[model samples]
Target: MTDHVDVLIVGAGLSGIGAAHHIQAALPERTYAILEARDAIGGTWDLFRYPGVRSDSDMHTLGYRFRPWTQAKAIADGPSILRYIRDTATEAGIDRHIRFGHRVVRAEWSSENARWTVEAVHDGKPVHLAASFLYVCSGYYRYDAGHTPHFPGIERFGGTLVHPQHWPADLDYTGKQVVVIGSGATAVTIVPAMADRAAHVTMLQRSPTYIASLPAEDPIANRLRRLVGVRRAYPITRWKNVALSTLIYQLSRRRPQVMKSMIRKGAVQQLPPGYDIDTHFTPRYQPWDQRLCVAPDGDLFTAIRNGRASVVTDHITEFSETGLRLESGAELEADIVITATGLRLLAFGGIQLTVDGRDITPPETMAYKGMMLSGVPNFAFTIGYTNASWTLKADLVSEYVVRLLRHLDTHGYDQCVPTNADPGLTEQPLLDFQAGYVLRSIDEFPKAGSRAPWRLGMSYAHDVLKLRYGRVDDGVLRCQRRPTRDAAIPAES
Candidate 1:
């Protein structure tokens, strides 16, 4: 017999855990199960175990809205964040509802029965699960491998090469010269993180990225928590950070030169005198065109000033036996090369989705409210914001899912599908990000619309009103009643 539930959540990460908590709190009677492909609870936190692995976003906004981050460190390490997520699950007994080692391969939606028949592989055995709704919390990136561009003559290099995603546990780099490729968050994090042990670390980037320095600990947030306690202070601090970040993004977009000058000034103040700020720090694109990389307490700058780390702005010629050859004919010797390139985008955990017998192609479908797809029924997925903290958008998406579920039950409907009836709705890329990883695979993802409900809301303040307080039956999402069959919605997984 196939297992069944009211909702089947396809991940155990922060989004999935938060989604579960909202469902349990709002609709106590509804049954749900979280199917985790990995053996652990913390999804991205668990998968990423490389040294110096930490969140780019601050803990206050990255942490769940319901849970206050009690730790002093605002820019938290990976293990700490993992502990927070696992602890959240354990405290709520959400751990009991997770089915680990279950990798969902495909999902078949049946309109006749108003259910989704999920196919998964668990311990080399096939397992079938039926649910009224499918919630995909599996993140947008390929967990197996990060994006690694082919370096010419890489095979000729005698030194050890490693990707940040699959960092070897026993790989030694003591007193060894290390060269990290790419100027994204991972590259910045790895440079200072490995600088202390390595002889020297060089960050080689094709072009500079917008990097901003933030304090490792937020003194204001800590002070507020101490004075008023976590319950009262969390939301206040959360909103404060949200507003500040939005204002900065707006300023960057509005007055690009002013923002550029300010950022350049900050880099100049932190770096050594006569440093090439224009060549090594300044980015060609406007800030927020790609994600702004964060360097906590100016750690990366400190590393550079101390001569433990350095940045090289140039194109790669090829990999040499000793090190990498630059287009400028300068050769940097390295004992180890770590490719901190980027991630490969994966949609719906790379699961094949079919509506009845017909296949659902993501490129053809349009995103409705940044959560549900326009032609898909009883489905939702979480894709976080590029501008601000990921959890801010994640929390909003989770709350909105609860609202969708409530509407289905309260109105005596089995399914709901968002249909694009507006002829004027112009299709745009789902994510406007220009990162190499995004640009490489954006065509595989769904499209966003030109207007409301169909447009992607990158702003948190706007999403709060639209998602949290917006009307559910807006005539676009058609909730329909099906012939009531013997619905076998189980109470638990």
Candidate 2:
């Protein structure tokens, strides 16, 4: 099947939906197609289904500016969030434009035609699409497959193995001992939820992660949302939430002892051992250096404090039938094992782009405000940070992309590529923090220069100011004539 559109959007998640909304609203006449890999929509939100999965970031910044979340819960669970994505897509009429089963295998740029030839598979059938511009909203990496350590006897274990990403909805764990591996957010979320029904839950971690337990719902904020629309109320709500979060984060940084004390209280309540608190509750790094996992209503910590769950801070030696063997020769038996390892990050499908047959290595290319790749014409990607909600950055990037598209259309120009080639330029990591995802995919992902049009800013206010209202003629973007063949669609497949 051969389809032609002015724009091709991959991934029907928050960013892709936002991009479609902007395009449909600003340029209704322009034709576009959204190609999603999954059979259904909602990228990451739809993918993860661990026991107590919810947003760590508040809904104010997590939601789109165009669409405000009216729910009373500031921190919502997975189902509600997925519904919100679906509702937004439907409300904006973006759902109908999506090709749900389409997965893009590879996309190659044709300099002669000044267009991208996107090749994808739709329901076991080949589909070809060509677009004047390509907007990639596919998320940073593969869905969390719950990193399973290669325990020596894992294959022989009698218990069921589960990764948070592929959790079975109907799997019963009640009255069964469960061992959850890894101290990441997914593992933390699963421990408490499983503790409610399981006979016992044990959390195993090599090193502790900084965890903050807070209320599930904010009373005053919920009231404000109910009284005023999300758009009008969001400012106060976001600022208030961010301010409090920032304060706690600062306290955890400046006074780890205080934070540590608070954590001990929460942990000892559930588990009666004084030594256990030091083992699983104490992290190696300062708070907020990595992401701080949030358990709404303090459920995870509360469960620990009440003796419903136990934490073991030790490396695993290997798997044993009906249980796990620790490095200290200790065996913990469980009916089910959940691996909450982390996700593997991939940048642009690890695709190597050659503009005019020149390799456009991501690290060598400048990221124009973390959206538009410098030297690539009419292309943008949606990337968020560990600090803020993914959509906050994505919404701004979507708007900027639409703005750039409109500017090109109005000026009667096409083929907008950044050709500023400085061979002597050095590349560096966008964020200073040491995150596995960022570090692993840094080379594959486009590099952000230390200055404007190359630097990646995680701040929402700064991005809004730059991407929303920044002048088009910033001397970084080079817009020129659309090749004569660009208007002509590729030959039918």
Candidate 3:
């Protein structure tokens, strides 16, 4: 079947839903549709079903800027988050516009046609659609698989081996020994959570990662909600959290030694009296060098103190019949092994892009405003901040897209392409983050520049000024009108 829309949005996750809300509210005349590959509303939330899964960042900044996060827990669980997403979809009537099971494989842009011809597969049948603009919100990581390195002798392990991305429903670990590998957000969350039912839970990491403790509920936010209404308190609390996070990130970057000392001191206060904090808690890199793992109210530490969970710092020589054998001549016994290693980075949802029959290579292009790509007309991809809440940058990108669409309508322009005219521009990695997933696949994504409108955003306040209020017709982005021999385009009311 063939379909046409003023805008075509990919992935009905947090960003896509938020984008639809902004576009529908501002430009009600513009027809839009969301193509979700999954059958559910919550993208990441629905995909991951591991025990004790929750948001690493607080919900205030992670939640939609337009919508108020009225929940008590600032660090919400997976089910709560999924419910929130579903509620948002239903409240906005955004679910009605979603085309589920539509896996978009390719998008072709035609200059003469002044639109994108999108090809997708739905229920094993080919589907065709056209749109004036394409907004990709499918996120950066691969949903189908998580990164699990080759563990020597993995086949010999008798117990169950699983990846957190695809957690099994029927699998039970009650009163069973569990060993989780890696020290990322997923591992920290799983270690404490599984400790309740497991005989013992151990987090085995090759090296240490920075793990910070945050309160599960924000006292200031709760008080404000009681004093004022939810809607009014939301923005205030959101900004407060944003400011606090920004300050931490900035301080960590500027004063690495001071921040590291502070973090170590905090860990010393939480763990046992004579615990080996140096071996298990100390990271070689500076704070925020890689993304810091969040531990709500020091639950991970509590689990360790109570002898429910423990941390092992060593390299895995190989997998044994019972568990993992470390290089330090130590063996860990386990009934279940959870590889919370990391995610595999995928570019543009692995969708092929062609412009006038010529393939568009992401690595060859430059990111414009960290959303739009250079020379890629009417195309934008939402990539959030690595240091802060993802939704912070995502909301900005959505607003920017809406503003750009409005500008196009105002000028009667058919195309707006961002061109990097500067010949002496220096190229850099799109994300400065040193996470294993990013390091493994950074070359597959677009490059960032050393200057403004080309460099990726790490600060929410800076993006607010740039994306929210900045001129849509910035010198870099060129707007043009071309004669199109096709059906009449919709006129502004």
Candidate 4:
């Protein structure tokens, strides 16, 4: 017999745990279960074991709104994040409801029964479960493997190659010359981290990315916490960070050259007087064309200034026997090569979905309110903002979902779906970011219309007003009751 639940949430990550908390708080009567593919909690945090792994966004904003981050450091490491997630689950008694090692393969929704029959693999066996509503919080990327671009003659390199996503626990890099490929967040993080122990570390990139140096501990937040306590300090700090991030993003979009100059100037100040900032620190593209890389306390620049690390802005033509041969005919010799490439985005954790025996492809549908998809019934997915802290959008999404569920319960509706009514509406890519990972997978994801309710506003302020306080019965979202046998039957025939 298939176990029935009011809601079935996929993934036990930061989003899933937060979703559970919201559901338990708002719709206490509805029973739900979280299915985690991994053997433990903390989806991304637990999965990524790379050195110097930490949140790019500060804890004040990254942390859930319901919970206050009591840590002194705004930029928290992976283990600390994992502990925070685990502790939240433990305190909320959400840990008991999570079924680890359960990987959902397919979800079939039947309008007749108004339920989703979810099939998953657990402990090398097939398990079936049914739910009234399905929530996808599995995150946006493939966890099994990261996107590692093939290099010419990569096999000829006689050195240890590592991807930050799958960093080996037992591997030793002490006194070794390390070459890290790609200039994204991972490369910047690993360069400074490995530089501390390695003989030397080099960050090799085809082009440059805008790098920002921020204090690990936020002084304003620290002062506020001491004065007003953590509970009050959190929201204040979160809003301040949100406004600052929004202002920067807005400036970058509106005045690209001005923002670009500002970012370059910041990077230049951190480097040595005669350092080639134009060649190494300056990016070809404007600031925020791709997400800016943040190095807490100018760590990456500090390492480079102290001669422990270096930056090479050049393309890799091919891999040499010892290391890489650049397009400029320069050779980089290294004992270990870390490929901090990027992630391959996966929609709905690659779980196949069907609506009453009809296959449903995410790319074919349009996003509704950035939470639910068009033509999808009783289903919602949490996708965070690219411009700001992910949890800021995540928390709003969770709150909106709870509000939606409660509306259904109050109205006695079995299903609610956002159908695209306007044929004239122009479709756009869900994300506007030009990051490599986003560009690689944008076609595979859903589209958003040019108008509101159909379009995704990447602003937290906009989302809060629309998602949190907006009416649930807004004309586009159609709610209906399940058809019963009696209702389908003719009175007299």
Highest lDDT model number? 3
Ordering by lDDT = 3, 1, 4, 2
| Least accurate 10 contiguous residues by lDDT in model 3 | 484-493
lDDT of 3 by residue, 76-170 (tens): 99999889888998998889999999999999999888899999999999899999999999999999999999999999999999999999999
What would the per-residue lDDT of candidate 2 be over residues 91-153, giving only the tens digit for each residue? 888998998888787777766777887778877887778888998889778653433446687
lDDT of each: 0.92, 0.77, 0.92, 0.91
Better by lDDT, candidate 4 or 3: 3
Q: In candidate 4, what are the lDDT values of residues 123-187, reduced to their tens digit?
A: 88999999999999999999999999989999999999999889899989999989999999989
Residue 347 lDDT in candidate 4: 95
User: What lDDT score goes with residue 27 in model 2?
Assistant: 90
Which parts of model 2 are misplaced by more than 4 Å?
Answer: 143-146, 229-231, 242-276, 350-354, 357-361, 419-425, 483-493
Candidate 3 residue pairs in backbone clash: none
> What TM-score quantifies how close candidate 4 is to the native fold?
0.97
- Off-target runs (Cα >4 Å) in candidate 4 are 485-493
Worst lDDT window (10 residues) for model 4? 484-493
